[model samples]
Target: MNLTAPARRARRAALLVPALLGAAVVAFLAQRPLGGHRAGWNGWVGTVNGIVFLAAAALPVAVLAVWALARRRRAAGAEPGWARRSALAEVGTLYGTAPWVWMILLPGVDPGGPRRRVNLVPLHDVAEIVAAGPPATAAAQIVGNMLVFAALGFLLPVRFAAFASVWRVLALGAACSVLVEAAQYALRLDRVSSVDDVLLNAGGAALAALAARRWWRRA
Candidate 1:
């Protein structure tokens, strides 16, 4: 029997991504660190908030795009059937989270109080939470967050298939959100660390995975 397509592609992509990311990272680090609070153009990975957003939004698409291009140009030797929808789902889930990540990260709401915890997590009242606004609304932050994971759900089962379990994938996305919250809290970045995000983010992924599974069955 011929070698498994996914296993072959994974092995190859694994080899390729490090080189691409490493080159970008090295190029990022080579620049000089300039003066001031949040200084200089050279500081790539300058802010954890932006970095988190970039990872969530851009890296998934970038890596997948590179993989697709390679698959298409396979030098008459190695090739694999590449699915566009699966990749799009994965990319959308990730990119959708970017706005929220940036919103939290950027120093916007000035906590005028002397106390460390000021409670600026948007929906303060139970009544407001029930009202439900647009995805970008502070009250509806969960919408974008969930949509992304839903995409993740579809992509993981349809594309990645065997690597990450549906539950595990949900957990992982939740974990990343937790990590971001922790990093922001610890670093004292321009954001608050909320346990609520972990819940919302995970919920999004679970829903996404459910949708994805259903789609696969239909396909």
Candidate 2:
């Protein structure tokens, strides 16, 4: 008897979660209080944001160039297969989300000093922002939160057959949001951790995933 692909995946799932968690832990230790605001960097460009932005900008150009060259070499042969497309999607996914992740991970600096703030109640802070009559900031924040994971929501289903559902996107987005919020709270980044942020982020990802539903891979 041979194990099916899904069975193989399920077997590996046992190790995948722990491995991912371990990597996340290591990344948390290496980046925060060390590579973040606590470090000796003096400007935004010198920070993770600038570094990731440059990398993201360069990734597609490099990947596509190689892809093009390979296609050219096989001009009289079959086109590149799932391996190439999947690789592009994987690399692009990382490149697309790097900036947002970098921004979220960047340590916040309190203009006055460091302080921990928390907003546990849902919709409370969002309502205040809306009620204050500065609709622009509120609107931007809501949309920005959604856009943080928009690329992942839009791209994941296009490549991976398993993530081709609205619910999966929502779950993935929520999980990612929780991690980011936890990191902010844990790192004492002088930022308020809010439940509303998670809602908006997850909602945005779900909506974007729906928009890309047409391109979702059929299982």
Q: What lDDT tens digits, residue by residue, belong to model 2 across residues 31-77?
A: 54345555555443446544543453464364666467556545645
Q: Weakest 10 consecutive residues, lDDT, candidate 1?
A: 28-37
10 residues in a row with least lDDT, candidate 2: 48-57
Instruction: Give me the displacement of residue 43 in model 1, in angstroms.
Output: 18
Residue 111 alpha-carbon offset, candidate 2, angstroms:
10
lDDT of model 2, residue 201 = 81
Query: How many clashes does each candidate structure show, in the order listed?
Result: 3, 0
Error of 1 at 197 (Å): 1.1
Mark the regions of model 1 whose C-alpha exceeds 4 Å error after superposition.
Answer: 1-70, 73-80, 83-100, 111-128, 131-139, 214-219
- What pairs collide in candidate 1? 93-148, 150-208, 153-209
Residues 125-197 of candidate 1 have per-residue lDDT tens digits of 3234456654347445556555544555556665565624667767867887777677666555545566566
Instruction: Evaluate all candidate structures by whole-model CA lDDT and list the values in order.
Output: 0.55, 0.72
Model 2 residue 43 lDDT? 40
Model 1 per-residue lDDT at 140 = 53
Q: List RMSD in Å for every model shown.
A: 10.1, 13.4
